[model samples]
Target chain A: MSAALHRIDTLAPRAEASGTHIAIAGLTKTYKTRGGSVPSLKPIDLNISKGEFVAIVGPSGCGKSTLLKLVAGLLPATTGTITIGGVKVTQPPDGVGMVFQSPVLLPWRTVRDNVLLQVEMRGRPVAAYREAAARLLHTAGLDGFEERFPWELSGGMQQRAAICRALVHDPEVLLMDEPFGALDAMTREKMNAELQRIWYETRKTVLLITHSIPEAVFLADRVVVMSSRPGSIEAVYDIDLPRPRDLSVMGEGRFVRYTQEIRKHFFAQGDLDH
Target chain B: MTDTLLVQSTRANVLSKLMSMDAIRPLILVAVILVGWDLAVRLLRIPPYLIPAPTLVIEQVIAQWPMLLRETMPTLTATLGGFALSALVGIPLAMLIASSKTVESYLYPLLVFSQSVPKIAVAPLFVVWFGFGVLPKIISAFLLGVFPVVVSTVLAFKSVDKEMIDLARSMRAGGLRTFIRIRLPHALPGIFSGLKVAITLAVVGAVVGEFVGSNSGIGYVLQVANGNFDLPLMFAALFVLSMMGVILFMALDAIEHFLIPWHASRRPDPNSGT
Candidate 1:
């Protein structure tokens, strides 16, 4: 465990020296309505290195989701810019996959076909990705159920299929907005383990947004907390946790301390979410 | 062993009896209604011209079977033609309305107003414009049917989860790709339900067109039967019309079953599978 912690200690400087995968420079977002302009995010800056996993946790309405949307290029930044893989992201970049809170699987599609939807929408030849989709579903423990529809699966299984869908295109970065928020506590833990395994194997840069302090600390290499509305990064903490951490690690002293530390922000804010 | 077998046999007997009752309940209700009508006519000595007995209606169905069958063709043709035309025009119009706010603002109010104008009152104008051929009846059907398709499809398109589109955008799926791959399929269930309502109205519209001018079809037959005081024949024609409406609705329902089998409404009960 100490050896793993030492590796994480070495990670930050090396990543900075090499160059960051995602760079946000003074990014802000404002939504215009008849009522007037409402600021969602303040001018925020963060750098995520290649193959790093970062999680952001904040109170409800804090605009952590808005930050993810800006990074995903689903919404334009009001001022400043976001760069991914050394290119300015004007629209959705070519190599990012996203998962929302709901599974959002096409009801008409079989589990495997839903995963292949990413490839199909991108104008890729679907036949070429068939094996890859099957392999990804297998990794999510959805083997032999490829022909099943979304309604046939439990909520947890549906979310797993969604995760598989996000990975099917072999993206360079994965963005998740409370992907497991709808799941039960027990199922959520299992999914966290599954996600960590997937991330460990793929080594893609990931940014996860969640309300659960334990979830954010359990999965992310660095945990960034944001303040309430018109959100800006409040603090950033290097997890200093071991790689390939299991669910039991959540009970460990370091993990509990991290969760406690993150939970303090939400408690102070008196948000309704908790 | 004998006691257990005896209990099992009795349980099976009760189950089978209950199953048969469920299957034949609707037929039993129909039988009671028909019997009551026949008895009322005979006991009151009512004239057949005023109200035909159920037996007389049955006799008319048997005696004029060939003529009824032939006249059914034209009415069927008009209904089918109008339904097809409604779908063809309405779907594209719905897509236009869904895609652009300007188009929606211009078209939606007009469409709603058109629905408020009764098809029966407007159908005579169609007969004058298109002549007494099947075309006028088809146009009448189209008028009645088109409204539901537009309204339902628009709702479906509007109701599509914004997050799903965000997911598509994050994948760099183009506008057309997102519409065809995501929005279109997602709207299909609501579109189909609209089509079902349109079909029922189309039947009424076609009959109204025949009432206005046509010399063929079941509508024409109904008019001729009324002139001659053929109450039994009128009832038979009404039966055929009701049956046609039911069959058309069921056919659309079956298509929905095949088209979107994974939809929540279509899927068999989770426990029913066992």
Candidate 2:
């Protein structure tokens, strides 16, 4: 590690080593569309540990993305509080990085420039993060593509670029909304493996929102399952798997067993308690 | 291997041949138009004073170059100057409108209503209000051009993927940062579309202003030509006006290509791959 990076790493209050990276308390979000006021997400509470890879999984339209958005402060909470690394998030909080399913890269910018977008917006000198960004891109297997445009790359390659862009600022927390949902099965699996490697390397707190049970099992230290629309957490499971997990591990009994367990919970019926 | 090389060369030759072949139909269309116009003038024995031949129109355009420039300058100034103003005012307004539903609700309907009224019919009113010379012409052109830009810009800003904004927020980007980094780039294509539509309309608006109450300009020249029954000069001025619109639109298209070459729509062809 460079002396400057070492200094930055120590100088900034350790976001991950702190007790919690993100804390959502009594969170609720309502949407007032022309159709009517639709409560997108009901009251919910979640706490994610520092440096942990947590995956939130639910059925489509069940508000997993909304939950993540609320945590990111992209959507204002109708009535609740969200704190990230000890800071209250009324608006978007700094030191948080994000990645989306579709890459969403600026078509005009080259890969390097796209990655530098965070710095540009923050009005930070690119020089401060250029080396770190280059290293992240290399780790993401995107070394030769710095000059390429998003359209020139494959779907997987663009997603890797998006991840690099998200992490270029060396953020404290990373929020991902089905970042690999658009890729083919094979590419998605490869990306899961790559993401695991990146998580191990950076130790940045990651909150991934995905619908795929297997993906959640493969990448996360903890899997958070949410209920249907007007969503809330149904269950949370600790993976207890070893790091540097191989693709072959995906075929192993332990991985399959965990995935099946999560799938069962996701589809389990709710009794008419009300 | 040798056979493969020969086949590839043959494919290249065939591709070039196909491109040239594609031009044939458009070329034929242009030839037919010219021949039809020439024949119609000759066979009908149309008086040059009423409907000049194509050759006479060209000759008059060239011979009256000084007069054309003198007449064209004011109109061009109004069209271009008003276009610049509209872009400046409309883009920021659209951004503001796009950012808030309340702004859009209040302003968008007003904008639509303003644009619905016939600009030509309102040109005399502008002349009455702003007076003749350049102010009325510029104001009329601005009024006509600004609407398309504002509408397209609003749509463009609205059309940005919500996921992208969430991604930025997850990365801890503030509203201004998100706007500058993500939303602005996404809105460029839309803004350019509006600009192109507005630019063409600007010329018509300038002419309308001139027609209503102008001491000088190509519209005034056209009026004089019509009054004197000089069809050649009228045809000449009309041709020049159309050329101006074409040139302006082409210029904007070129700018779009240069600025956002990675846009899928901007990609030339899969065959070129450049």
Candidate 3:
């Protein structure tokens, strides 16, 4: 426990030295409905540095996803600015990829075509990205099944293709919204390790919103715990786990300490399962 | 070695099941119905003018094949022409309705209102305006067939997973790109469903037009046969019409299967052990 505390203490200085890649200042979101305006997120400040893996974990309806969407520029911030790589994001920022909870693949497209969807969407010549797509699919362990359709693949494989699609364009940042939430526990654990390896290799700055405490600890360098409804940052715990994390790391002392520390925040609020 | 054997046996099991009696059940039921009808008509000694036996209908079809074939051309032409027109017009209209709230609010109700008015009732009006020609038949078919395409397409576009749209936006996909790559492909199964219904309706619409005013088509032939007391010929024409509907429907089904084999509906049943 003391060692875990010491690791958390060291994260701050290292993060400052690396320099910020994504800066969120006074960001908030209020959804205007017919009845009245409902505040989803309170004004919040957070900085994620280049190649940093940050996971935002909170109770359901805490607006953790709202924060991610604001950064992705899918939704406008009610008040404040989000600058990524020194530019303000008014519309969706370029060079950003996202994976949703469901695979959401095009049923008519094969696995290879689905991965190249990013290139096609950008109006870039898909022919040029063929090699890159193949490599990414290979990395995802989906090389032999490029011609297969989404329904032919299992849920885990489909999600892997979604990840490959996101990365095919070599995005600067990858935002995920509870990507493995639908998977069984064993598959989710496997995906966490696969994601960590991918992150290590690609080194894209990532912000993942998740409900699972262990998942956040397993994959993220820092876990940002948020308060329930009208969410605001409660605490940010630096995982401080070693690089290239595997499932075995979950059994380590620091890993359990990190997960427990984050879980305690939700346990206090009486809504932790979600 | 055991794993490969297990997989091979599973494949064989699925193949055998597919080729089993279940595959031919529909054919057997059809044969039974026809045989029953023939036997009942012969035993009761029903007058051919009132209700021709299946054998007499087949004899009439064989004897008048040339005339029947000639009349079938116009009906086929009108059905195909109007269905094509509906697809061309309805798809864009649906896209317009789905993309803009103003268009949807104004036009959607108007479309629903138009759909409520019995299309058969409107067939006479089309003949009065366009005259007793193929144009009126085509117009009537277009009117009847277009509603399903528009409604189903609108629903399809609306029902696209919101998360998938967010993924596209986060990747900096423009509105056009999003529609082409994400919205269009994602809405295919729904669109094809609409197309199937519309194609069948197109056949009905053509027949309705002929019933109101036409000298060609199977409907006109049926009217002529009835006036001359040639009940078997009338039944043969009716048979041709039903066959046309089935052929067009099966064609659409084949296209849907080929295009979206990845869809849940097209996937092999899991319990079949494939």
Candidate 4:
């Protein structure tokens, strides 16, 4: 087999092939405004298997983030349905964790308390999850800063706290919309490594939406490419790169080739799309 | 070296405390204004009744301290009572309006309409309904103050990022849980700003209520001073009333500081974190 498979049908066999975790069938979105209804997403179909990491890459205004919101059940689809963990998702489903581009942590809360917010919001006993919150913060390299406020930490640290908040409830599905998009280049690369380590330990099903081609190639088991404006899936590439990936892996030939392959789509469309 | 360090640090501390922009700038401006007013009144030979010198006002405060103290108590009670009432009721009302379309549609317009009707006009109505007791003054204060708290709180609750609410929903947090954990805390800074405005307005409301009808309070003292044509006493009452307004505003500011030190407005202290 070639290093990356572009065909949707010719994909390799996997543990989750028999059972799709997050199934999106003909999902679409149209926003209503005073002017008229504007199409945001064309009918899109994709399947993310349990414990698999998938990253959707597209140019700005492509609605890749919309797709993630749809799967997370934060938004109602214009057409079709989404299923997560064998249940139809009408409202925001349980056992799902989401992180946005901004940290979105409460300013009044300490880092530890912000993480425990997930547990507290779920009506769970906060005392029980204290250790879990502490461990998650520790893993995120924020052990000593648990009592600190979100503003006291750097941008990367705040996002780390937000990630920990997402996982504190022990949600099986982790949906991220450009989680490290706000960080500087160096910090983003480090966060990518940190995310990989966290994912390695937890093995949660993750659907990350991003514009960076290399970020998509580096983190995902499969990279789904999206079109601009009324976005639809353009191509899917299976990443055959070795896991337990690090910052150094980004420099490898395989990783560079995958990113270049994805970048080719935007270049073909227009330079302005990137 | 130690002695020099101590001296340098002490000088720095004094300079910062005396010259800092936070509180000292405003204090300096007030001092300038008072001195300029004193000079202008003496130079121009402005009559005491038109604008008494600051010195005469200070002397009036000292001479009639007992009477002023007696009147101040009632106004303070009414202001605090009305402010507390508005906060207790207004926050929940804001949450209701934010969460429900039905409440927003019916109640929001009515609230806006209520604001359009002047509080001075409503003060007489409150006095007529409740008689000349402190209840009328409190109701007047509540009428003037509640709108800001509700409006600010509503805007604050609505301004919370849609993603934050989604994150809560995905965690299986119900409506109340989403509000308590996410919405309420996020809305605090806005609510506090509204409270600060409301507190000052509450003082004005109490005075207005007394102007319309009242036996006690600083407003009554002003009315008596007006009848007597004792300009210094009038200036003293005005001075005391303004001081009370500042004190109430500062009280809310202090509360805001204690509650949300993590907020950007409260984090200007450079030596806060290590």
Candidate 5:
């Protein structure tokens, strides 16, 4: 069992050598309220290449989620451009899937129906995706439970279903915003391992927003650290971790070093105590 | 053991459990109320014409069963018809109001003003305009039933989790698709609550219209019985109307159970074992 759990392979960084797949140039966001204009995200430029896993870590109230939303085109950038796969995003773009902090499943829908929601929302015939939905559910370890409601499942299971719903449409990029924030500590660690396996299999470009430094270092090939309020990228660290990462990897020296390095930024800003 | 025998034993166990004190408490209370009412009438020596005993009312109901059933049909039809009409009209209006602030601003005040006007007072005006027919009763019932549906539906649509909406938008789902797949299903429990309230109000609205001006219906019979000082017959009509309300409410409750058993409200309590 230990040998099987420790089976590992290197994740060759394909995106680093290739040209960018998602390019952001001087992106900014500001809210215009009655009082005045409040800047949310400062002008920033970043690029993510195809089949890469990138995680953005920041303090609470930072614009990490705002950046993800801008890239997904759920919210418009205040100034510059977000181009995905050579197409500039003016509105919600195609070939992108999103998983939120909450599972957000419709209570009326069964697990299979929730997964098929992607096809239904795209105006496609749901019957065509029945097999695909079943496959995704099986991959998520939710097989034989497709007819169950969201409320019938545990929190981790619900989040797994949410991930299946996002990926059922075969999108090129997956954007996740604190997807495991609601889980217990033990479940969160288990989910991180599960997510690593899914990422290795699917190889979809991913941009995840999270607050946990260790989580960012564990899942992401590149960790983009952001500062709070009027958020901007402070630094980017490239992770040299192996693929098929297990919970045991979190105990290694390099892993601690990476997490400590990210923690220093928050500690310096006096935000860590909170 | 045979599977059928095992199933039979389990079913019998469930039936016995249902007859336990917790399950039959409401029935016990109802019995006490009935006994008290009968004793009060006997002790006060109230004239039968003023306030007949429960036994007298029951006897009157059996003797006048044919007339009562005939009159009941019109009231039941009007009540159900008005409630259905409200659901059809009000839900769409709610969607419109939820979709745009301009529409909500224009319609909300008008809705509040209409609700503020006592429906009983409006019943006479409906009779004046539509004449002494079922149309006036239906209109009156509609007026009373629509408000709850509209208000609750709007609240339900607005209460949808923002993250759910964001997830849908990120997938490039169009507005209509989002509404059908996400918003409408999410709003169902709230809509059913409104429908439950509206259905009971519809019963009252139909009866009010009949009282104002009508040639048929139990409400009209009630007015005639009151004039002739036939207390038992009036009580019989009142009993039928209450039963209709209870029946409609239970029907909606059953539908809610079937449709959204995943909802927190429908989930069996862990401690209760039901």
Candidate 6:
């Protein structure tokens, strides 16, 4: 397995020069529940390039999230290895950031103070990051709401603040697990565009997990589809499209075709046309 | 949408609210209570020793101001001293328990046991151990006050959202950083609740110690007054005790407000704030 992964590492020098950020080799995960040890993700290998926005999509209960967690080091990989920035991930990397599906901002903290939390926790001076945090908040369209508590904001606004918090630390890798899944459809689309813009502006590598086929097609440079329960990589589809894509692109034929192709792999080989 | 009408209506609403803020209902209720008390005292002619009239208690309080102040000093000292000690010890212990499950499990039952013991009954032991000096009263106050602090600190510590901790970890925050930045701030309200309850109990505990054995304090005055059948003086001492409790509690509350201006409990009601 090491020899096989070494071949991939040999490919890494060429890719590294071209900016490859994370490389996963035969990554597998299992959970030791009360009943028994249950496998979550089957052994699978994949690589996410630097500055790339990749989305993992599958049905509910699929291990797409598990894959993200494994890479994030929230959980340990049972029988495989994950490398970020050419280093094996044994724990949550210092340069990795995560955004959950829920806007998990501390309710007691004001919006600005909440963003500064990451910096403060890192023992970094808040003075150094204060302007940067403010800038990020403004980028998320939360300019004047810095002093507002989480409860004072609407759901969409709170989630936006959460995103700002994730980016405030300026991590090399951003792991997002259905960050906009809880938002309304209109807000979700808006948030998606905002996220894309942020990703483009920051040029940070992002690994987003979602169950939405269209969402995957819209945001990802490549869409990695997984099978349900005991999940493994079914296929990886490269979304060959232009940068800074508009929401109107979804109405175009190419977008629909990519979404259809991804959906076909997500469902079992059956009446996929239906 | 019309500017003039909107401004006029808003102003009218504010004016109407202000007008209704008069304490008519509360004043009437106080008046009715006083009348009922006076009527009950006059008709039933209950012993002044058992249930002294409000008038007599007030007169006693005014006349015995010099003696009361002399008593107030010692009692207030023990209450404040014990409360301060509890805050210092209990908060850190709460932090320790909150940070570790092992600490919580081991100490939680002991904390419960500490509160379960009848505080008044244990006052004599404090006197025996510490002598009939201020030490016993202070220890009594400390014992009573510490429980609320521990309970509150534990509650505050536990109430910190798991998501926030994860957020901090993903941001590369170390354990100490997480506590200072996230957990401690999250636990403030609960800690304050404990502090408030502890302050009130501190007075009770101090008095209990005085009751058992003391050369000074309002509790000693009460005992002496009771022996001589000086009902009015006893009532005055009791009134002073109640006033001291109120004053201490308010002082703590004020400190809380000053320290954590953003606390929800500290925020005045928007509708009621004049």
Best-matching candidate per TM-score: 1
TM-score of chain B of 5: 0.90
Q: lDDT tens string, model 3, B140-245? A: 8999999999999999999988878887777678888887778887899989999999999999888888989999899899888889998999999998888899
The TM-score of predicted model 5 comes to: 0.91
Per-residue CA lDDT of model 3 for A83-108, tens digit only, reads 99999999988888888889988878
**For residues B1-274, could you state the per-residue lDDT of candidate 5 as single tens digits?**
6999999998989866766756497777878988998999999998898889999999998999999999999999899989989999998999899889999999999999989999888788887899987888888889899999999999999998988888788767887888878888889989988899999999999999899999899999999999999999999999988888998899988898888777887777788755
Which CAPRI tier for candidate 5?
medium
Question: What are the per-model DockQ values?
Answer: 0.79, 0.47, 0.67, 0.70, 0.70, 0.46
Candidate 4 C-alpha lDDT tens digits along A61-176: 88988888888887899998899988999988888888998998888888998899888877788899998998899999997899998889999999999999999888899999
Q: In candidate 2, how many Å is residue B2 off?
A: 11
**What's model 2's lDDT at B71?**
85
lDDT per residue (tens digit) for residues A159-267 in model 5? 9999999999889999999999999989998889889889999999999999888888899988888898899888777788887888899999888888877788899
Show where candidate 5 strays beyond 4 Å: A1-16, A125-128, B1-18, B21-27, B258-261
For the candidates in turn, chain A alone yields TM-scores of 0.94, 0.90, 0.96, 0.95, 0.93, 0.91
Superposed model 6: Cα runs more than 4 Å off? A1-19, A124-131, A264-274, B1-32, B267-274
Candidate 1 stretches with Cα past 4 Å from truth are A1-14, B1-28, B42-46, B271-274
Report each candidate's C-alpha RMSD, comma-separated, in the order given: 3.3, 7.4, 4.0, 3.2, 5.0, 5.6
Better of 1 and 5 by DockQ: 1
CAPRI-wise, candidate 1 is medium
Error of 1 at A199 (Å): 1.3
- lDDT score of residue B82 within candidate 5: 90
Residue B124's lDDT in candidate 2: 89
The digit string of per-residue lDDT tens for model 2 on A180-265 reads: 88899999999998999888889998999998888998898788877887787777777767888877888887777787777776
